[model samples]
Target: DIKPIEQLNINNLINKRNFRGIFGTQPPLSILEEIDYIIVSPGVPFDIPIILKAIEENIEVISEIELSYRLSNGKIIAITGTNGKTTTTSMVGEIFKESRKDSYAVGNIGLPMISKIDYSTNETSFIVEVSSFQLEGIKEFHPHISAVLNITPDHLNRHKTMENYIDQKSRVFLNQTPNDITILNKDNPITFSFKDKTPGKVILFSRLSTLEKGVFIEDNQIIIRNEEKERLLVCPVSDIKILGGHNLENALAAVAISYYAGIPIQSIRKALKKFKGVAHRIERVDIISGVEFINDSKGTNPESSIKAIEAMEKPIILIAGGMDKGSDLSEFVLSFKNKVRYLILLGETANIIENLARGQGINNIKKVASMEEAVLFSFNIANKGDVVLLSPGCASWDMYSSYEERGNIFKSLVKDLRR
Candidate 1:
């Protein structure tokens, strides 16, 4: 390890201090004056005082993605969007592995790209699940193939505006050339519009329509096309083990990325059939007394919870609410009109969601003080055919450190009920 910055004598630093080493957390704002470059992390807001100061002073700011790109000697397929990124990235990585390629699934999926750059060689492939936070600071971080699965109203609290968020997401392909590939969701109006702006060969994927030039479902089989000629048949949509139509869209995206990476159709199909989706994403926790309990704690925004709600075929008692991210709850509340028979809410946004539900004429709303209370209350009211879903439409930071913690607590509470 390098010498500690704390090793510098305070008196000497008072006389002549220069940056010495990394700050474990945030260094003193005074250190900003001595630094010439600041590589911002994704979690650090761009409007923070130090960042603003850097911008004012013309200090170079780049994301870890940019640093990794500069150091990489491998190919990258970066996936970004408001949702479906983790599932798609994992699927792509599995397909690459099945096809016998050296691949690492990094970025927002967990591992930082910067931590894995030295592990890359010419044959290594990186399947990155990027977020707008990471993209906002990128300068020349271009991927060999990039896909924006879909963009919706998400992270508005961070990016502040829908326009700004879209612009940041577009940076994924900003530096790509005609030799590279850009994948877009044809059904998403925002992402589909980027076809004209993409500098590379734009390929579109659709779960709702048959695309002339990308990937689409026809007769329940996933197919790919290029220049009006059908290239390959990936797997039958029904063969995908993941539940929901939303997952079908994710499958189409992963198939497009893996196939373009030269993975064979058989390998893609094999991966699709085996991949059972990621945890905390519409994951089935347990069933007791003929009632199903599903954990979707990863649904931290309105649009994501709406998808989870739409995927439910049985009557559901939804347990929602968490730290508010300044998302609109109108659409999310309205989605409960059909399937959600009972709404059990908790956390900071519980009252806010309950109010929205009442406005939508959803009168069966109950607010709880804790996750255990919410689960027990839901179990009390749930019928034999009803499903209890914990798809919180807000962040978990108000009560827990992460969504994973929230989901684990929910799972544990549900298991305790079984005993």
Candidate 2:
């Protein structure tokens, strides 16, 4: 019999004396006895009770990412982090294309890796954007080059603790042997601390210091070095289309991976120079009445939003807030005082953000009900030489499908206003 868990509906409930049960609640005691394996989605938190019960019954539980990784045959370049995974993954894929290699980009960036299984061939290399949730259930999933970009406090609601989240992300290297390459952020405290834990060959990428075996920025030029030799005068960080220090770090990581993957330095430089950053990531929409409108809807955490704010040179009419993901707003408070001239809050987390801003002595905070309201409010508040930035520091699920949807809506509204 087939049964649906939670709100899912089951088509087949019972058959003859076999006796199957469809459960809206937790699986009944009888049904639990017959179950063999359980596939959990990222939305479902890893519960100790369920795991303990599964162990007691000798049943195996796995995640969808694990299943895809197991079935995948192509060489995988897996990228994981709190932010910049999608942009870096896309950049790496573009580099492969520029080098005339057959490549497919998949995983958490949008396309499910499993869906592209038929597209795979002996020549295809998969550039996968993985999340901590996806990393949790791997058994034998190993990438040719796996990168842990940077880990900040994110998804605390789902992971329940920072340690748990870090553990989940560390699984990307669980099955990796010494031959496999692990690209890590040398500047990130959390990722840097894992140098001793990783079994694979660790390659460091940094913007802070010069690295002997990875990519680093020194004198405005990106320098890439491996054990055998070094490649210098790569490109200027200023020439990169993507804004902010965070993106530079991302580019460094992507460059390190592409170079190690056998893509020529010329091809890598061409791709980096030509690549306009991913959408919803500091994408400039239009200039309205001398005010610059920017969309950073992908900033769904405090750290990301803080980075966005720091990237702004002019005074900002900042649009922020959504469904709270348990990130502290204290970091943004000082940024608001320094960079933001006005603050517009929207969605479920608006009041909380407003309160936080108010407590920080920021009097320019305004709470709005919808994205349109926030946009209009920002337009009214913004002046010549100022920026109207949508860098909501929380999830968009409270009012939109995803951060992409939120960004699209912001763009559409700005276009309508312009017309």
Best by lDDT: 1
Writing each residue's lDDT as its tens digit, candidate 2 over 137-177 gives 66778788889999999999888889999998888888888
Model 2, residue 19: displacement in angstroms?
Answer: 18
Q: How accurate locally is residue 316 in candidate 2, as Cα lDDT from 0 to 100?
A: 93
Q: What is the lDDT of residue 343 in candidate 1?
A: 91
Candidate 1 TM-score over all chains jointly:
0.92
How many angstroms is residue 396 displaced in model 1 relative to the true structure, after the best TM-score fit?
1.7
Q: Please give each candidate's TM-score.
A: 0.92, 0.91
lDDT of each model, Cα atoms only? 0.88, 0.85
lDDT of 1 by residue, 32-114 (tens): 77877988878788887778878888898888888888889799899998889998999999999898899899999988887
Using TM-score as the measure, which candidate wins? 1
lDDT of 1 at 221: 92
